[model samples]
Target: MISVVILGAGNVATHLFRGFSLAENVSVTQWYSRNLTTVEQYKNEVDITDDLSDLKVADVYIIAVSDDAVAKLSSKLEFENRMVVHTSGSVGIYDLDKKHNRGVFYPLQSFTKGAAMDFANVPICIETVDKKSYPLLKTLAKNLGSPVQKVNSDQRRVLHLAAVFVNNFTNQLYRIGHEITESEGAEFDMLKPLIVETAKKIEDLSPYRAQTGPAKRHDKKTIKKHLKQLDDNNHHKAVYELLTKSIQKTHGRKKL
Candidate 1:
């Protein structure tokens, strides 16, 4: 069995801790968090320590801390060439330094604290310093029911940026849609079917090809009506106009 130690008590840490606990041949032997109070709920299940020096011996130390804290926390750990990995999408493997067998085990999905995660569906991006640690990271990812891919640091950075655009920005758009409906005294639930269908269509079709509605069709009348419906919020108005212009430009149409 592979003994693992996890760092942090935030969203990624919580998801990984629970997911790893469910995997066979893997035991989360220790958990390290600077905040003693935050580690209370998990202390009974595993060895929890606020002091980095007191960290228990484990085969792998998975650092699930924030991107900024990675280098600092890693510098404090005295693990002697042990397998150390971080669960960050944007941060590269080199950020962990060369004092240990470092790698990255980035899960390409948004994680929320206290939310149940479907590990089998999340794609895991793996990277290592050299060949020796590559297979180990790959095996661990497979045990988590994730499809693993070998990616370089530069490529991973690009993927991370693309993920922000696709996931984070798209979610923001949904939030705007929800707010718009709420302000108009319309149920946000009404957009559920349309949202699901839009996502499903994109699975098989390029977003550009799957484009519909006023902007795609250059329906000037509908576009004007929608813009008129916007309140005095300049930010919302600018967003709508910018997106509509982008869609039209992509489809080879003149600005309305």
Candidate 2:
């Protein structure tokens, strides 16, 4: 079995702990958090500690902390020359302290505390400096039924950027849609099916081909109406105008 020690108490760390705990081929040897109260509940299931000096030997040490804390935490580890990996999308593998073998086990998905997550559906992007560590990481990912993809630092950074557009930015757009619907006393729930279908469309068609709506069709009248509807909310107006112009530009149409 692949043994692991997970560090941090954030959303990503929590989800990773849940995924690992359910994996028959994986054993969570220990869990560490600077704030003992955050992970204290799991003490009965696995060793939980706030002291780095109290850490036990494990096949892998996963630093699932924030990006800014990764380096400092790695530097603080009392052991060296062992496989250590971080769960970060944008941080490079070299960000880890040079004392140990460095790698990344980035699960490319938006994580929220207490949200249900199936690692089987999450794509795990991995990068490793030590060749020997790749297979181990890959096996760990597969054990959770995740699709493993080998990506370098640059590729991972680009993926993270695209992810922000698809996940974060898209969610913001949904919030705008919610506000707009609520303004008219319309239920945002009505748009659920459309959102599901829009997502499913890309499964077979490329985003370019799946594109639809006024911006893609260059329906100036409809576009102008949308901008007018957002006139009361300048913040939402600017977002709408910017996205409309972007879609037009992508389709080789003149700026709206």
Candidate 3:
């Protein structure tokens, strides 16, 4: 059985705990959090503790903390030479303290508390200095129903950048869509199907080929109409104009 100790009390940590719980061959030895109130409720379910000195001996230590706190937490760990990995796509794998065997276990998906995660489609990006440890990570990913990907620090960094565009920035655009619909006294839920279909299109066609709408067509009249609609909202207007110009440039229609 692969034993693990998870460090952190946030969304990623909670989700990882649940994922590991489903693995029959996996045993979560302990969970560490600086704040008691955050992880206190989990005491009955698992060995949850606040003291770093009280960490359990486990095969793997997964630091599911923020990118900034990863190094600090790793440094605080009293254990050394144990397989330690941080759950971050942007941060370098070597960011963790050098005392332990450092690695990366990045789940390439946005997580929300209370939301169900089917890791079947999730890409688990992993990296390690030792080749022998690769199988352990691969097994963990398979147990979690995620596809394993061997990604180095630099590749993971750029993958994170693309993820930010596809996930974070896309969510912001959804927020903008929500705002625009609300302004027109329309329900935001109405756009849900459109969003789903737009995402599904990439499975069969390239984003460039699947592209549509005013900007892609260079329909200046429709673009002007959209600009006019957003006239009262300068922030939206600026964003729309910038993206339209970018799309036009991408499709070789940048002359205008």
Candidate 4:
């Protein structure tokens, strides 16, 4: 079995720890956090430590901390030239410097505590400074049942930015839709089927090809009516107008 140690106790840490614990060839030998009391619950199954010196030696150290703390925490560790990897999407592998055999094992998905994650379906973006460490990462990723891809820092950053647009921005739009429905005493659940269908269609069709509604059709009357409805909120009105104009431009139609 490949002994592993995990640093940090946040949502990502919890999710990763759980996932690794279930893997047959990987054992979480140590769990480290600044707060020993908080992680004491896992002590029966794995060693839990607050002090860096108390950290147990392991074949691999996975840093599941925030992007900003990765460098500082890595510098504090006495890995003795062991392999180290971080689960950050936006940060580069060089951020860990020459502290150890540094690399990135960023899983491209949002993690929430106690929420189950299907690692097999998630894409694992891997990078390393040492060629020897790359295969170790790929093997570990495969064991987790995720598809591993080699991506440079530049490409990873671009993928992260695109994820924010597709996931975060879409969620924000849903929030707006929900709020609008609530204000009119309508059940937001009514949009559930439409939302699901919209997402399903995009799996087989390009977003542009699947586009619908007044914006895509350039229906001036409906567009004007929606704009007027959004007039109560300047932000919403601006967003609607901008998106409508974008859809019209995409279809080579003159904006009204």
Candidate 5:
């Protein structure tokens, strides 16, 4: 069995703890948080501690904390030469202290506290400086039904950047849409089907091929109408104009 210790009390840590607990070949032996109250609920299931020195021996110690804290926390670990990994996408593997085997177990998905997700569909991007530590991490991921990708630090950094565009920026766009609908007293819920269909289209078609709507088609009438509808000097108007221009440029349409 692969024994694992998870350190952190945030979204990633919560999801990993649940995933590991259900994996047939993995055992989550300990959970750590600087504040005991954050992880107090799990005390009945596993060893919980606020002190780094009290951690027990384990096959893998996962530092699933914030990016800034990963290095500092890893440096504080009482053990040495053991397999230790962090769940950050942008943070470099070398950021961990040199006292132990350093690797990354970055799960490339946006996590919200208490939101339901299936690990089987979440791809895990992993990297390790030591070749021997790779198999253990891969096996642990496989047991959670996660597809594994071996990526170097540079590649992982790029993936995280792209993720911000697709997930974070796209969500912000959704918020803008909500505000627009609210201003017109239109039901924002009516756009739900379009949103789902747009997402599903990318599954079988490249984003370029899936492109449609007024901007993609360079319909100046519709574009002008949209610009006029948005309030002057508003941030939403600026975003609409920028995206319209971007889409037009992408499709070889001249400025509208």
Candidate 6:
């Protein structure tokens, strides 16, 4: 069994620790957070503490903190020359303190507080300077049932940017849709099926091929009507016009 010490108490850290707890081949030796309250619940299962001096010996140390804090926090680790990894999609492996064997264990997925996600579906992007360190990471990821990918820093950063566009930015659009429907006194749930099918459709086809609606059709009448309806909200009108023009450009249609 591989022994791991996780340092962080945010959504990603908590989710990963939970995944490790369920895996038979992994042992979570310790967990830490700057604030004790964040990790107090796990005290019975693992050594949960805020004190960095109390860190126990482990095969791997996973630093799952915010991007800016990663370097400073890892530098503060009194332990040295141990295998250390961070759980960030955008941050490169070299950002960690140089005293230890550094790498990345980036889980490419959105994490919500206290929400359970299937590890098997999570694609873990691993990067390491030493080739020998790969199999250990592969083993740990596989034990959690995660599909592993060997991603370099450049590719990982771009991948993270793409993820934000698809996940975070897309969710904001969903919220806008909800607000629009609510203003019309209609139930937002009415769009749920459309949302689900839109996602599922992309699974089998490229988004370019799956593109639809008045913008793609270049129907000036419908476009004008939609813009007129959104006139009360200048922000909504601006976004609508911008996306419509983008779609027209993408589909090789001249703007109306």
Top lDDT: which candidate number?
A: 2
Runs off by more than 4 Å, candidate 5: none
Distance from true position, residue 171, model 5, in Å? 0.7
Q: What range of 10 consecutive residues in model 5 has the weakest lDDT sum?
A: 225-234
Residue 218 of model 4, lDDT score? 74
lDDT of 3 by residue, 16-122 (tens): 99989998888899999899899888889899999999999998999998889999889999888999999998878777899998889999999998899888978
Return the lDDT, model 6, position 252.
Answer: 91
Clashing pairs in 5: none
Off by over 4 Å in 2: none
lDDT of 4 by residue, 1-256 (tens): 7888999999878887888888888888999999888788888888888889888888889999989999989999865588989989898898885969989989998887877898987899999999888988888888788899999999899999998988889888999888889878999999999999999999999998998988777788988888888888898778778877888888887675
lDDT of 1 by residue, 167-195 (tens): 89999999999888888799999899998
Residue pairs whose backbone atoms clash in candidate 1? none
* TM-score of each candidate structure, all chains considered together: 0.96, 0.98, 0.98, 0.93, 0.97, 0.98
Kindly state the number of residue pairs that clash in model 2.
Answer: 0
lDDT of 5 by residue, 1-256 (tens): 9999999999999999999889999999999999999999889998999999899899999999999999999999989999999999988899999998999999999998789889998999989999888999999999999999999999999999999999999999999989888887999999999999999999999999999999998888988888888855379889988888899889997697
Which digits, one per residue and each the tens of the lDDT, describe model 6 over residues 1-256?
9999999999999999999999999999999899999888888888888999999999999999999999998899998888999999888788898998999999999999767799988999999988899999999999999999999999999999999999998998898898899898999998999999999999999999999999999999999999999989998888888888889999998685
lDDT of 2 by residue, 1-256 (tens): 9999999999999999999999999999999999999998888998999999999899999999989999999999999999999999898899999999999999999999978999888999999998878999999999889999999999999999999999999999899899999998999999999999999999999999999999999998998888888789999989988888888889998767
Off by over 4 Å in 1: none
> Would you list the C-alpha lDDT of every candidate in the order shown?
0.87, 0.94, 0.91, 0.87, 0.93, 0.93
Candidate 3, clashing residue pairs? Answer: none
Cα miss at 192, model 3 (Å)?
A: 1.2
lDDT of 1 at 252: 89
lDDT of 4 at 63: 93
lDDT value, candidate 4, whole model = 0.87
Quality of model 3 by C-alpha lDDT: 0.91
